[model samples]
Target: MELLEERIRRDGVVKAGGVLKVDAFLNHQMDIELFSQMAEEWKRLFAGKPINKILTIEASGIGIAAVVAHHFGVPVVFAKKTQSINLDGTMYSTRIQSFTHNRIYDVIVSTRFLGPDDHVLIIDDFLANGCALRGLLEICESAGATVEGIGIAIEKGFQPGGDELREAGYDLQSLAIVEAMDPATGAIEFRS
Candidate 1:
């Protein structure tokens, strides 16, 4: 987690509208080694949980989820941002508002991937507004799956999302928590 925090401090960019762009290594160009290290940390965090599957939302979540799934020895299921031809009639869908993009997307997951027997661990690249996390939770609920836990790479603690989820009694873990950011000064404060 320290490694991730350091990476964010070095490469992450703070912009207006509370956006922290980690495009250099995380949200854009991929860093497999760092991802592997993160996966190991998540594995340690959820060591005893019955994680049968890894669930995530598409676009940014897929790569991180895939690497993490390797540690769990399970398949990765990513919720689709749009309705795709591959997805059949039976699917769990929810609407999510993106804090970064400032748009709502109808996210969907195939019924075949999730079910009552599954113990799911949701993974994502960032936790901003918690909309994506809520949508994934809804999908798990629809499938009657037990949520083992939620793992996030980075969380914007200044946002209400992470606090709201924690207050809701969910077991959530974030690698790097940004307590505050100053765009003008290019300063980022991490939670101690």
Candidate 2:
């Protein structure tokens, strides 16, 4: 996690309205080695849990989830933002508001890939307001699956998301928790 914090300090960009863009390594043009290290950290943190599946929302979270699933030796199931023709059978759907995009998306997951037997580890690129993760949790609830834990790459500690999840009794692990950010100075402070 120190590696991730250091990377964020070096490469992360701070924008107005509390946005931290980490596209250079964390999300857009991914650093697989960094992701692998993050995955290893999560694995160590959540050790001994029966995590049979990895779940994440589509788009940014997919790449990180894939590498994490590989490390866990489990299948990764991403909740699609839009329902496609390829997705068949009963689907668990929920609405999620995107903090970055500033839009609400109807996210869904196919029933075939998730069920009561699965113990899932939810992974994502970022957590701000807890909307996306809430939607994914709803789908998991509808499917009657056990949520083993939640793994996040970056979390804006100024926001209520991460704290809310932890208060709700979730075993959430965030690699980098930004305690504060200065847009003008491009300074980021991480929680110790």
Clashes of each: 0, 0
Tens-digit per-residue lDDT, 51-168, candidate 1: 9999998898999999999978999999999734444578888888876667878898888889999999999999987888999999999999999999999999988889899999
Cα TM-score of candidate 2: 0.96
Please, what is the whole-model Cα lDDT of each candidate in the order they appear? 0.90, 0.93
lDDT of 2: 0.93
Overall local distance difference test of candidate 1:
0.90
List where candidate 2 sits over 4 angstroms from the true fold. Answer: 83-89
Reference-based TM-score of each model = 0.95, 0.96
Clashes in model 1: which pairs?
none
In terms of lDDT, the poorest run of 10 residues in model 1 is: 82-91
The best candidate by TM-score is 2
Candidate 2, residues 75-130, lDDT tens digits: the string is 99999996333435588888878767778788988899999999999999999989
Please list all clashing residue pairs in model 2, or write none if there are none.
none
- Candidate 1 similarity to native, TM-score: 0.95
